[model samples]
Target chain A: MNWAFFGGLLSGTIMYGVPLLYTTLGEVIGQRAGMVNLGLEGILLIGASVGFAVSIETGNPWLGVGAAALAGALFNLVYAFLVATRRANQLASGLTVMFFGMGISAMVGRAYVGGGIAGLARYQVPGVAALPWVTRTMFNYDLLVYLAVPVAVLVWWVLYRTRWGLSLRAVGENPSAAFAAGRRISALKYQAALACGFLAGIAGAHLSVALARTWTEGMTGGRGFVAVALVIFSKWHPLRAIVGALLFGGAVTLQLQLQAMGAGVSPFLLNMIPYLLTLGVLLVWSGARRFAAPGALGRVYSGEE
Target chain B: MSAFTSPARRLRGACAAGVRVVRKGWAIAAARYAIVLAIALLAYAVVLLLAGKNPLQAYSDTFSFTLGSWYGFSEVVVRMIPLLLTAIAVALPSKLGLINVGGEGQLYMGAWLATWGAITFTGLPAAVFIPLLIVLGFVGGGVWAAVAGFFRARGLVNETITTLLMNYVSPLIVGFFVYGTWRSREVGASAFPQSAAFPEAARLPRFFDTRIHLGLVLALILLLLFWFVLEKTAWGLKMRAIGGNPEAARRLGVRLGLYIIVAMFVAGGIAGLAGMAEVSALHGRLRAGFSPGYGFTGFLISWLAGGSPLGILTMSFVLAVVFSAGSLLQITQGVPFAAVNVLMALILFVVLMKPRLLGRLS
Candidate 1:
C-alpha cells in the first residue's frame, strides 16, 4: 500500500479500536483479581445511553463521561456482592448481571431513542497535527484516545510492580493465602470490579459520544465481550491487551474498507471476519499449556482452609 | 494375593460412593431452586406494587392474556418455539462446560440460510421446500457454532467471547443482505428495512387453525430426543462425564475434543432451527428485528431450568406467558414493553440470590 493508504488504514484502525482497547485494559485488571464481569456489555450499553443523554441535556461531554463511569461502577456493586460475597457461581452470576444491566439500560434509554448528542471535541497537539501523514493518525483524537495508553501502562504497573498489585494477584491466585496474610479478599475484588466498571464506562462513553456520535439499543454491540477475549489473547498483560485490541480493530477497519470498495463480497461474510479471528486466536491461545490460566481463576474462596 | 478381594471390588465400591455423592448434590440443587422461586415471587409482587398496579390484577391479567383464548394460547406456543430451540442451544454446550452465547448469531445465520433456500427454490412444492429450508437453517447454525467449537477444541480459545462476538458479526451479515441484494423493492414503509417475503410453498403449515405452526411440535420432538440422549444413552454418559470433570473423563477414555465440537454443533443447529421457524412459520421473512431477543431469553430459560429438558419446557412456557403479557401490559397500563424484562431480571436475580425457592426440583 502507498503511504497515504497506510496512514489512512492506521488512523481508521485506531479510531475503531480505541474503545476496545479501553475496555480490554479495564477487563484485564478485573480478571487479574479473579472476577469475570460478563456484565461489561450491559455496562457499556448503559454508559453509552446515559452518556449521550446527559451530554445532550448538559452540553458537556466530560460530565457525560463521568456519569457513565458512575453508572457502570454502580452496576458492578451487584456483581461484587454476588461473586465476592454470596459465593455464587461466577459464570451464572455474571450472566444475570448482564441481562439485568441490559434490561435496565434499555428501559432507561427508551426516551432517548434517535436522539443525538455532541461528542467530545477533538484535541490537537499544535506541532503533531501539522505533520504530513501522522497528524490524522495520532494527533486528532478525543481525550479518551490519549487516556488509553497511559491507563494500560498504569494498570501494568499496579498489577505487577506495586504492593497493591501483589495483594490483588495473591487474591486471584490463592484467596485463602491472601486472607491468611490479612488481605481482605472480598474488598480487593470489589475494588478491582469497580475500577473495571469505571474504565468500561469511559469506553462506552467513547463509543457513543465519540465514535458513533449516537446511542441505540444494544449499541455497545458486543464490544465488551470482545474486550474479554482480548484480555485472554493478551494473556492478561495490559500492553498486550492493547495489541490485541489493535488486531481486532484492524479486522473491523478492513471490513468497513472492503465494504466501501464494493468488492462484490457479501457483507455478511465480511462482517464475520472479526468474530472468526477471535475464535481462531482463542483456540490457538488455549491450546498452549505454557499459557495456562491462574490456578484459581473462577473458584470462590470460603476462607475455610 | 487374595483372589476374592480384587481391584474390581474396590472399583465397584467407588462407583457406589460416586452415586451417593451425585444424589446429595441433586438434593442441594433442588432445595436451592425452591428458595429461588419463593424469592422471585416476592420480588415480582414488590415490582407490581411499585408500579402502582394491583399485584393481583396484574398477575391475573398476565395469566389470562397468556392462556385465556385459543389465540393467546397459540401465541404462547409460537413464542415457545424459539425459546425451546434456543434453550437447547445453550443447554447442550453448557453440558460440555462451554457457554455458547453466540446463539443469536447462529440464529441469524440460520435465518439467512433459510431465506436463501426459500428464494432459490421458488418452483419447488411445499413438501420439498419446507424440509430443505429447515435443513439449511440447521446447517447454517451448526457451522456457525462449529467455528467457535473448533477454536475451543483445537485453538484453546475461550468459547464465551468467540460465541458472543459471533452474534454481532451474524446480524451485520443479515443487515448487509437485507440492505443490499435482498431488499424488497415494492414495500412502501420508509423506516423499516427487511427482505423479500417467502412464497407460500416455503411457509410452515399452521397448527389446528391457530397462529402456532408445526415448528413447536418439531422443537418438542427434538427436546424429547435430546432428553433421551442425555439421560439414557452411552454417548450421553460420556458427555456427562466430560462435563462434570474433563480431566477425569479424558483419563477414562472419553474423546474430550470430539464431544466439545459435537455438542457445540448440536447446540448451534438447534438455535438455527429457531431462526428458520421464525422466518418460515411466523414472520414469513427475515427482518432487522426478527429475533426479538429470543437468544438471550433462551439463555435465561436454560439457566433457570438448570439444564434439564423437562425443566426447560416448563420455564420456556412460563417465560412465554410473561413475554405475551408484557405486550398486553404495555397497551393497557401504559407500561413499557421492557417492564416485563425488568420483572424477568428481578426473578432471575432473586432466584440466583436465594436459590432455595423451587425445592427438590431444579
Candidate 2:
C-alpha cells in the first residue's frame, strides 16, 4: 500500500530471485545441452551445506561460494558420466542423484546445526546506499545480487549468438547430426553440464550464506526443483529464466506479505501458493505454446548412436 | 573318414562360438553389478571412517535392531506397510513410462480423507466404517495423482515435475484441514495440530499381538495382485508396450492418454491405501508431519526393484531393516538418522547402474 512497503518487497524479490535465477539459468543451460540434471537440487543441497561449512571454517563467504561451485561441478560430473556417457535413463538417474544429494547433505550438515557463523557480508554501493530511490531496492545485498543479471545476459549471448552455443543447441536437438557435422557433442555436453553445476553451486551457496545465513540440513527447501520448473516456464531461454524467477520470487514474497497483513488466511494455504503457481504456470504455458524440449533431451548419446 | 571329420570339426567350431558369446555377456553383467556394489560400500565406509566411527559396529547394531528378534521383525513389518504400497504407486506409473513421484502427496491426501471420514462417520460399525474410509482414501489419492495425469495427457505437462510439485501441495492441504476444521479441542491433544483420534469402532484390527496390523496382509495381497496384473493381464501388456515405445503403441491404436491417466489413478489409489492403513491401524489420529519421507523411500524401493512386483517385496524388507536399524542406530550409537538416508540413496544409485550395464553386456 505504501511506497516504503513496495520498495521493501522489491528488495525481497531480488534477494529471493537471485538464487532462483541462478538455478533456472543453470538448468536451462543443462537441459538445452541435452542433459536434464534432475540432480540440480542435490547439487544445491550439497553446495549449500559444503559452502556453509567451508565459509565457516575459512572466515570468508567468497571462499564458501567457490567451494560450493567446486562441489557442484564434482557432483554433476557423475551425472554427465551416467546420463551423457553411460546413456542411462535421465529421469531415474537424475532422481537418484537428487536423493543422494539430499542424503549426503543431511549426513554432513547434521553437525553444523547451531554452528553460529556469520553470513555473506553485504557490499553496498558507497554512493548508491545514500540515495533515497535506490537504498532499499538495490544497494543493500551481497555481490551475487548484482552479478546474477549480467551473468544471465552473458549466458543468453552464449546460448544464441555464439558459434559454440549453436553447436551446443545442435547437440541437444540432434546429437548424431551434430556429430556428423564434426562437432564434439560429448565435449559440448560435458561443458554445459559442468557449467550448470558451477552455477547451481553458487545458487546453493547464496541460499545458505546470503539468505538463511546458517547451516541446516536440507535447507535449499525445494528451490532447486522450483528452478527446474522455472526453466520449462522460461522455455529454455536464459532471459526468460530471469523473468520467471522474479515472478516466482514475487509470488513467494507476496505470501509472506499477505500473512503479515493479517488477512485471516491460513498459513498452510499460504505455503501452497508457490507450488500451486508452479503447477498452474506449467499447465497454462504448455497449452499456450508447445514447450519443445530438446529432441535428444533425455537420450544417451554415444558417438555410435 | 574325411567327410566325417569335416562335419565334426564344423560342430566343434559352432559350440565354441556359442560359449564365447554367452561368457562375454555374463561376465560384463556380473562386473557391472560388482562394481556398483563395491563402490557403494566403499563410499559409505569412507564416510563412516571420516566421522570417527566404526562402520562394522554400526552395521551390527542395525542388524540386531531389525533382523535379530521377533520384536524387531514386527517393527520391520510395520515399516514395510506404507513403504511397499507407495513403492507400488511408483512402480505402476513407471510401467507406462510415466514417473509418478507424488506418492507422498497421494498418501497424505488418502490419510486426510480417511481421517475426515473417520471423524464425520463416527456412528457406523468398524466393519462398515473401515471399508468406507478405505474407499475415500483411495479415491482421494487417486484423484490427486489423476490431476497430474490429466495435465500430462491434455496439457502435455511433464508429469515428473507436476507430480513432484503436487507433492508439496497435498501435505499443505492436509495441514489446512487438520489445523483448521479437524483440530481437536480436547485437552489432551489441544497443544498439537492434529485431528481427534478415530473412534474405537473405526480403528483397524491388529494381528499377532503386535503393532503390525491387518495392513501387512493387505500389502501382501496387493503385491500378489500387482504381480498378476503386471505379468499376465492384457492391461499389463499394454502398459509394457507403452513404456517400451509410446509412438509404436499409439500407432497400434492403444489409447495412450487414457492409459496414462488410468495408470496414475491406480498408482495414487495404492498410495492412499498406505496412508489410510498407517493412520487407522498404527496412529489412530492424523498428525502433521506424519510421514517421514515414506513416499521417497517408496520411490527408492520401486527403483531398486526395477518395477518388478515380487522384487519390491524383497527390496522392501531390506530397506525396512535398514530403516528400523537406522532409528536404532540413532539412539544407541548416537549416529544421525541421515546416515541411513544416505546409505539407501547410495544403494539406489548402485542399483540404477545395474540395468544399464546389463543391457550393454547381455
Candidate 3:
C-alpha cells in the first residue's frame, strides 16, 4: 500500500524480471527463425550450474557469465543437431534436449551444490539514484538487470532491422521458399539455436551469480517454462517481451511478497498463480492470433524438400 | 493342386501363413529394438567415460542390480505399472494427434481426488471403495485434461502448451492440500507433507510379497483395451482418421472436437490410474512430490514407441530397468540419479535420428 512497499515490489520485479526478459528475448529470436527450443529449461540449468561453479572457482562473476554462455551455446548444439540437422519432431526433440540438459547440468553441478560466491556487484543509477519514491529500491540493481532492457532492444534491432534477421524469418516462415531464395536453412537454424542458447545461458547466470548467489539442484524451478510462455505473451517480439517478462516477474514476486507479508492464502496455492496466469494468458491470446506463430514453427525441415 | 485340396487343409494352410507372418513381424521388431538399445548404451558409455567413470562397471552393476535378482525383477514390474499407465495416457491421445504432456498434472489431480475418496468414504466395503477410488481417480485426471482438450478442440489454444503449463500448477495445488487441509497429523511424522494413510479398503491387493498390486492388472487391461479400441472398433477407426488428417476427417463428417476431448479424457484417466496406483499401493498415502517425473518419462516412452502398444510395453520395461538402475548407479558409479535422464534422452535421440540400419534390416 505504501510507497516503500510499491518500490520494493518494483525492485523485486526487476531482479526477477531481468533473467526472464533475457530468456524471452532468446526464445523470440529462435521462434522467429521457426525453431522453438522447448529444452530451454535444460539450457538455463546448464548455464546456472556452469556459471555458479566457474564463478566460485575463479572468484570472478563475469568469467562465470562467459563460461555459462559458452557452455550453453555448446550444449544447445545437441538440440540443433537433432531438430535442425536430423529433422526430428521439434516438440519431442526439445523435450529430449531438456532432459539432456537437466542430466548434464545435474551431473556437472553436483560437486558445487551448496556452493557460494561473491555475487555480481550492484550499481546505482547515477542520476536516478536521487529519485524520491523509487530511489532506494528501483535505482539500484546488478549489471545484468541494467543490461536486460537494452539487450532486448539490441535483440529487437538484430532480429527486425538486419538482413540476417530477414533471412532468418524467411527460413522460419517457409524453409522451401528461403532455400529457393538461396538461403542455407539449416545454417540459419543452427545460428538461431546458438544465439538462443547464449542468451538463455546468461539468463541462468543471472539466477545463480547475481540473484540467489548459490547453486542448487534444479534451482531454476520451471522458470524456463515461464519464459516460454512469456514468448507467446509477447507475440514473439523482443520489445514486447520486456513488458511481458516484467508482468510474469511481478506474478512471481507477488506470491513471495504476499507470503512474507503474512498473507492468509496458502503459499502453495499462491505459487500456482504464475502458471495458471500463463495458462490464462495463453488461452486468451492464443485464440485470436492465428498468424502469430511462424508457419514453420514446429515443422521439421528436411533439406532440399 | 490347391483347387483339389480339402477345405479343412486349405484353412490350416492359411492359419500357418498367418503365424509365420506374425513371427516375422516379431523378429523385425526385436531387431529394431536391439539396435536402438545398443546405440543408446554405447552413447551413454561414452558419456560415462567423459565423466571419468568406468562405463563397463556401470553397465555391469546396472545389469546385476536390475536384472540379476528376483526381487529386482519384481521391483521392475512395480515401476512398470506407472510407466505403463502413463505411457498409455500419452499413447492413446497421440493416436488422435494430441500431445498430453499434462499427464503429470493429471496424475496429481487423480491422486488428490482418490485421496479424498479414501479419506472420506472410510466405511465403505473394500469392493465398493476400490472401484470408487478407480472411478474417482479417472474422473480427477480426466476432467483436468478435458480442460486442455476443450481448448484445443475449440481452437482456443494448443493442448501441448496448456498441458505443459498445467503440469507446474497441479503440483502446487497438491501441495496446498497436502501441506494445508489434507496434512497428515500422525505422531512424530508432522514434518512430512502428506495425506493420512488410506484405510485397509483403499489399499490395492498386492501380489506375492511385493509392491506389485492391482494397478498392474489395471494397466495391462487398459493397454489391451487401448489396442483393441484403436484397432478393432469403429471409434478407433474414426480416431485414426482424425489423426491421419483432421481436415479430411472433418470433411468426411467425423466429430474432431468430440474425439479430441474424449481421447484426452481417457488418456488423462489412464494417467490418473498411475497416480492412484502409486499412492494407494506403493506409498499408501498421497505425498507431495511423489513422482519423479513419471508423466514426462511416460511421454518419452510413448514417443519412443511411436504410439504402438507393443512398443509401449517394451519401452516401459526398458525404462523401468533404467529407472531402477539409476539409484544403483548413484552409489556404484558415483554419479547423480539424474544421470539416468541423460541415458534416456540418448535413447530417445537415437530413435529420433532414425538410423537407416533398422529400416534396411526390417
Candidate 4:
C-alpha cells in the first residue's frame, strides 16, 4: 500500500477507535467499583438517538453531548436500582435494560431519519493541523478524538491516585472491608455505575452525531458491546482499554479500506474480523494469565451479606 | 374462664399469620403480571394515539386479522415455527445456566449452510436430499455453539460475552457468502442480496393450501423431546444441578464442563433447524432479514416462559399473535412495527421488576 493508503487507514482507525475508547474506559471505571453494567449497549443506543436529535434541534453539538449523558445516566438509574439495591441477577437485568433502551430509542428516533447535525469541529492547535501528513492522520479530527486520550489518562489517575479510587477499588475487592472503613459501599457503587453510563452515552453520541453525522435506528451497531469486550481484553486498565479500542478500530478500518479497494474479499467476512479478534483475544489472554476480576463484580452485596 | 380464652386467642393468632403469608405471595405474583400488563397497555396507547387512531380499535383489528381468517391463522403458525425453534435453542442451554445469545448467529449459519447444500446438490431425490440438508443445518448450528462452549469450559472465559460477540460475527459470515462469493447470477440484482434458490427436492412439504408447512410439526416434536429430556432423564437431573449450584454439583461428581458443552450443542442444533425450516418451508431461499429477528424474539419468549418447554410453545404462539397483529396494525392504523418491539421490551422489564415491586407492596 502507498503512504496515502496507510494514512487513510490510520485516520479511519482513529475515528473508529474513539467510540470504543470512551466506552471501554467507562466500563473500566464501573468494573473497578465491582459493578458490571451489561446494559452499556442500551445506554449507547439511547445516547446516540437523543444526542443526534438534540444536536439537530439546537444546532449545538455540546448540548447534544450533555443530553446524551443525561439519557445514559437515566438508563443506568434503572439498572442501579435493580442490581445495586434490589439485588436482582446482574446479567439478566442488564439484558432487560438493553432491550428496553433499544426499543425506546428506536421508537423515539424514527422521526430523525435522514436528519443531519453538525459534529464536533476539528480543532487546529498551533501548527499541528497544518502539518502535511500528520495533520490528517492525527490532529485533524473531531473533538472526541482529543477527549478520548485525556479521558483515559484522567480515569487512570482517579483509579490509582485518588482516595476516592482507593475506596471504590476496596468496595470492589471487598465491600465488607470498605464498609468497616466507613465507606458507603452502595453509594459508591451507584456513583460508579452512573458515571459509566455517562461515559458510555458520550460514546454513543460520538458515533451517531459526531462520526456518522446522522441518526438511524440501531445505529450504535454493536460498538458498545465491543467496548465491553475491550475492557476484558485490557484487563480493566484505562490506558490499555484505549489501546484495545484502537486495535479494534484498526480492524474495522482495514475492512473498510479493503472494501474500498474492491479487493474481491467479502465485506461480510471482513466485518467479522473484530468480533473474531475479540474472542481470540479472550482465549489467548485467559490462557496466559489469570485475570483477576473484581470479587464483588456482578454480585449484589448488601451490607448484611 | 382460662379454657374459653385460650382457644379463642389461638384461633385469632393462627388466622393472622396465615393471612400475612398468603397476602405476601399473592402480592408478589400480582405485581409481576400487573407491571407487564400495564406496560403493554401503555405501549399500545402511545402507538395508536400517535397514529391518530383509538388504541382499542387498533388492538381489535390486530386480533381480528390474526384469528378471523384461516389464512391469517396459518400465517401465525408459520411465524411461530421459527420462534418455537429459537426458543428451544435458548431454553436448552439455560437449563445448564448458560445463556446462548448467539442463536441469531447460529440461525444464520444454519440457513446459509442449508442453502449451500441445497443448491450444490440440486438434482438429488427429495427423500435423500431433504434429510441431508436438515442434518447439515443441525451440524452448522451445533458446531458454532460448541466453539463458545469450548472457550467457556477450558478457557474459563465468560460464555455470555463470547456468545454475544459470536452473534455479531456470524451474520457477517453469512452475508459474505451471499453477497460476495455466492451471489445469484441468474437474478443479477445487487439490490437484492440473496443466495441461489434451494432445489425443489430440498423444499419442505406444505401443511395445507396456506404457506404453513411440516416445520411446525418438527417444532412441536422438538418441544416434547426437550420436555422429556429435561424432566424425565438423568441428563436433565445433572443439568438442573449444574445450573443451580455448579460448585456443589462438581463436588458431588457431576462433569460440569461436559454437560454445559452438550447443552449448548443441543441448543444450537435446535436453532439451526429453525433456520433450515425458514429456508426450506417458507422463503425457499436464504436472504438478508430471512430470520426477521426471530432469534431475538425467541430469546424473549424462552425467557418469559422461564425455560419451560410447554411454556415455550405457548409463549411462541402468543408472540406470533402479537407479531401478526402488529403487522395488521401497521396496515390499518399506520402504527410502526417498532411499536410491538416497545411492548415486548416493556413486558420484559415488568417481569424482571415484579418481585421487588411486590416485596414493597406487601
TM-score of each: 0.88, 0.91, 0.97, 0.89
TM-score for the A-chain in each candidate structure? 0.94, 0.94, 0.96, 0.95
DockQ of 4: 0.44
Mark the 10 consecutive residues where model 1 chain B has the least summed lDDT: B353-362
Could you arrange the candidates by DockQ from highest to lowest?
A: 3, 2, 4, 1
Q: Which of candidates 1 and 4 reaches a greater DockQ? A: 4
Per-residue CA lDDT of model 3 for B267-290, tens digit only, reads 999899899889998898889989
Q: Find the candidate with the highest DockQ and give its number.
A: 3
lDDT of 3 at A135: 48
| Poorest stretch of ten by lDDT in candidate 2 chain B | B353-362
The docking category that best describes candidate 3 is medium
Candidate 3's C-alpha runs over 4 A off are A303-305, B1-11, B355-362
Poorly placed runs, candidate 4 (over 4 Å): A129-137, A288-291, A302-305, B1-35, B43-54, B187-191, B251-253, B356-362
Ranking by TM-score: 3, 2, 4, 1
Q: Which candidate do you rate higher for lDDT, 1 or 2?
A: 2
**Candidate 2 local lDDT, residue B148:** 88
Which has the better lDDT: candidate 2, or candidate 4?
2
